[model samples]
Target chain A: MCVLCGGFVVQEHWTEGRGSTGAASVTVGGGASRERQRDRRDRTAMANRILACYGLKLEDWNGSKYIVRDVKGSSEIVHDLGALWPAVEKLIKKTADPLDPALIGRLQQQQQQQQSGRP
Target chain B: MAANVKIPVIILSGFLGSGKTSLLTRALKQPQLANSAIIVNEFGRMGLDHHLLSRVEERTLLVGGGCVCCSMREDLVNACMELLEDMQRGAKPRVDRIIVETTGLADPSPIWFTVLRHPVLQHHFHVESVLVTVDAVNGMLHLDSHDESIKQISAADRVIVTKTDIADGEEIERLRRRIGQLNPAAEVELTDSEDTKSARFFADNPDSVRSPRTRCAMAAADGGREGRSAEDGRNGSGGHTDATHSVSIRFDRPLDWHAFGLWLSMLLHARGTDILRVKGLLDLGGEGPVSLNGVQHIIHPPEHLDGWPDGRRTSTIVFIMKKVQPQQVTSSLLAFQHMLGAVPYVLETDLQFPY
Candidate 1:
């Protein structure tokens, strides 16, 4: 159980890895707290790009939790990336096949557009 | 359980006739092992009824995929939990270590998943290593005809080719070569079980395999990974379509932890079973490299080292996989990084990348 808010303990997902306490300095001089927020933003944006394929959005909630919502505005609170994919599959009602050729093609197209500075 | 120490679990796995029991029996003779608990599949299999101290009943858990073998292995996590509780309550003697001897056809993933995923168990127990034994006499035949054998070999941190006393050196060499190709990171040892006190016996250096020494990263030669189908295809599982294969990729710079985690979770959610195991040291540009270890779908909680083991920050990950195309895995990863505008990763074959 958590001691701070007196709530149930949260299982640290593999994705969070070492988390902020043990986090390495990805942003050289950004304080650990700032680096953590930056890390959270990067995750939200990157995940949103992929979820766009399924018409979904992910928001970094308080730099600790994530809210994944579908095009229909249905949302779920995901503890971490470990729970995000399963939550996604439930929202879309389909296998979130990461290797699906179609999904890969979309990512490829977007990557190329970014390379050429295509807005 | 102490906040700083975790009990180590060593898993013994291999084909039905492999010398797992024999090795354990021999090791138990050591006075130091008095504090170790053994979890065998069944008493009949171990033939050590008197040694069976306690039996842990199976408890159904809402974990892992819904498969018959998976459900049975859930009992393994249950066994470990009960053992922990008994020790804590002084009902059972506290063991410094756990030795689990899996069934001949057991897949080590579910047991690993449950151990690493359980909120309570994860804190008290950590898998030290998976020691796989192969009978040197028929090892080649088994590898060529059994998918289970390949899975066991791939998941091993150390592969003991036993029964070498009577087996032909030629056959043993061939089997060892096959194991190396399947899992280049696994150290293969030739052991004549008759020589019970052989230098390669267990407990000499139980930490030998888990020493965080990352394998050298290199591109796999094409066509080296081809699965030898099992003789029986009637099982309808489409079991061994993709031959056991491994690939290692290195990133010149450190990884963006956020992106890496997202990509990995998506991959495991879709194709966890295809990935037999993965190990690596990822530099999140933190104080030290973050170690990553996983068995199929379940990943052990990452440990932040005090410093880089070799004073280098290059990230290298080796994936022991099956049926999954290595190119697709790398391409998707690179694509994710590309979207984040993070440094693009180089792979063995970037051409297979749709971009």
Candidate 2:
């Protein structure tokens, strides 16, 4: 399991045994299964969990190749396993807009005033 | 740009306390490297004070006669650009070679990308080699614990094992073997040896190194399926859950270039971060032999060698990766080749088999 993200890390070994060509296959996680239904379920579950964590939703899509619409109505494709993290990060950034310096300073002053009053 | 006049730059990288500075100090003293410019990155803890004891200027020092040492103030590209400008303005001494010594925990790929891919730098500078200093006494422990050390060893063209005087002979041998496993193409030299010369660090011909076959042969003899974990048997050291591992694949016949390229592109796209280094000598049907070198996601344009390094004309590729299994790489290549209908050889019984 990845500690940073609460995703289950799977190590699936797919071996291609041929006569003495001596090839090896190793994959970390994602899209290794040949069963389309299972692959779809796994990818959707992972994506939905990531989206929920960032308070977003998948509005629409055309199969797994492309994401037609998200909560923001953006048309984008989740190309491969590697693209998942970047997509999540983008969604998080969009949701949690950077706080202004003045606003941050105001919040800090208010907290200090409240603490002083309690004392 | 004048032809054959680019300044050769060597990137000296190692983990903290790996004796990179000591090696540089010795190398700078050599008469052959007198006119060399050394760009040393200042470590937060050490602060380059030892190197700055004899300063010619604020951030620059003249060490060992004519060698100029400057502290890297900003990004490597800017530092190198400034050095070049200084030379042009006659502000700094003229130099034939430049050595960029990275911080202990630095990743060499970015520096390499800067040198090789930058438009201006590429035109004026050529990568001479990547020289890594590995401490013989604590090298194995460091490799087991630190990802930086693994990347340092993996990306090296030449590895200088220092502090061998204090390390156990058997332990040193073990470390040497492990280093070979991590990077088979690199030439390993002991710094403690009397015959070891500073000039040898600068002397490297990518073509002269032994073929991947010689290294892969050992793995192939073991049937290539068994994976050896670097963490086994060592106690009290940091765990190697994310340690780097190596895989060597050999093809008996020529490969389809287009098919191989497609597979490699897809693979890098998917697992580029995990892949530290990929070096291969390829046999492409009638096109002859070519060398493929890659660090992380960046694949340098392939170089065509005059002939095979060894008599063996087979295609062999060695991949050093972190948290990646060797079996997955080999099978994926074979699968891709099979899909493209470009499988090199076929077995008599299994018509669909891809070899």
Candidate 3:
């Protein structure tokens, strides 16, 4: 199980893609979609979860595009994140790149290790 | 697992309007790229290229931010995992190759490192090549004006000259020569920005196209600015510019899996803010090396590929952080090693409960 938004929430046995059994109701727990918003991290995780339900491979790279690839094996367990209208609304709306520096920094460090033979 | 499959990623990097995306959209349409996956990193709130590619099988992940080498790397790794998962779950189309179309200001080094260093990612992916796209119409000017541009050229595994349709061929050739001097090993291809399917630029198997001399080029020349960490300045204290950066850690021996996870969780809980990405490739005893990657705070569930994609045996970890001391991180890892019964340490609990 992966913790999202600093473990403020817990999601286990997450559905991998969106199902075709009629669309899921867009209401999140808070009731109002327009007025209420979770913390940024939680919102992004929620978006990830939503993508999971849609059965789409949810991929994000800090900026604007969020990718959803179709899953391969079992159609039942997969949930689609984009299928939930409310979830898509949330992810598309939240825009911030928090892990940018770390991603590049680690890569440069690896290049150094490979060159120097440092384990 | 198809052990015979070798997916070599060719990265097209350059600054905006330099024709990076243009070249990629064109490359995807080529018949040779039929088995390729294209991952695009877009900047800002809206993505443009996601809707531009004509191939349905070309997986697209648009990451918005400063540059892929820094900010959106987790997404890059996660994208790969999801692509694999999708393949396994029968959700997404499967491809034999991959390509990452970077933002204009992207520094190709980090993107390359993600594939080369991340424990989980390193196995399934390889830095087959780094293709830097240069806008010929503004090549010299861009190089003279931007520090990022210089880094792009220096790090390229291949240099592609774009927008030659608008510039004089002689001047474009001169620009090509300049690129060659900066990156002597890279193969330079001049392309008309608008033409995508021209046979002139496409190759059947890009992985086999490198010259023997280029393949044998000095590691120092390819090292670029990343090598400067030891010599550039700042007293060799891992002379890093950004506080939150990624560093890869490796362990050759089989990890005490439980201990390693405990150490990581404790570190993340305490300094998660400073640490942005953590991906490990490890010898988990009987199961082979399992790959795990985390972004910001979300760790994708660990996945096991067939085996090491290459024969290399070091269990590695690439850490992406913010301002935390590398020594502190190293020491903590060392402490974990000692906890693994490899080093002497004073402790109360034998096989501690939490770990």
Cα error, residue B283 of model 2, in Å, equals 1.7
Candidate 2 local Cα displacement, residue B202, angstroms: 2.2
For residues A1-119, could you state the per-residue lDDT of candidate 3 as single tens digits? 22112211123211221111122357766564332232223333543432343343444434223343445532221122212222232343432112234422443454455558954
Clashing residue pairs found in predicted model 2: A24-B327, A24-B330, A24-B331, A25-B327, A25-B328, A25-B331, A26-B327, A26-B328, A26-B329
- Per-candidate TM equals 0.79, 0.60, 0.41
Name the fnat for model 3: 0.04
Q: Which CAPRI tier for candidate 2?
A: incorrect
Please, what are the lDDT tens digits per residue for candidate 3 over residues B1-355?
Answer: 1212435566778876887766766666667766667677554312334432222222223222222332226667777777777767887566666777777876665665466545566566655556778888887777666767766765664577888889997778667655543443346777885775642343433454322112312221222223323222222112223232334445646665444543454354345445554544555564444655443333434544334534444455545455664445654555345333232121111011222
Question: Which lDDT tens digits does candidate 2 get at residues B184-277?
Answer: 6566788863433665575333343322322323222232233333442232123562356666667766765544553564355446677787
lDDT tens digits, residue span B6-107, model 1: 777777888988877887776676665656777876546444444454444434454334532223256776677788888889998767677777788877
lDDT of 1 by residue, A3-29 (tens): 101112346666654632323245556
Q: What residue pairs clash in candidate 1, if any at all? A: A24-B286, A25-B285, A25-B286, B227-B243
The top-ranked prediction according to DockQ is: 1
Specify the CAPRI tier of model 3: incorrect
* Candidate number achieving the greatest lDDT relative to the actual structure: 1
Per-candidate count of clashing residue pairs (backbone under 3 Å): 4, 9, 64
Instruction: Return whichever of 1 and 2 wins on TM-score.
Output: 1
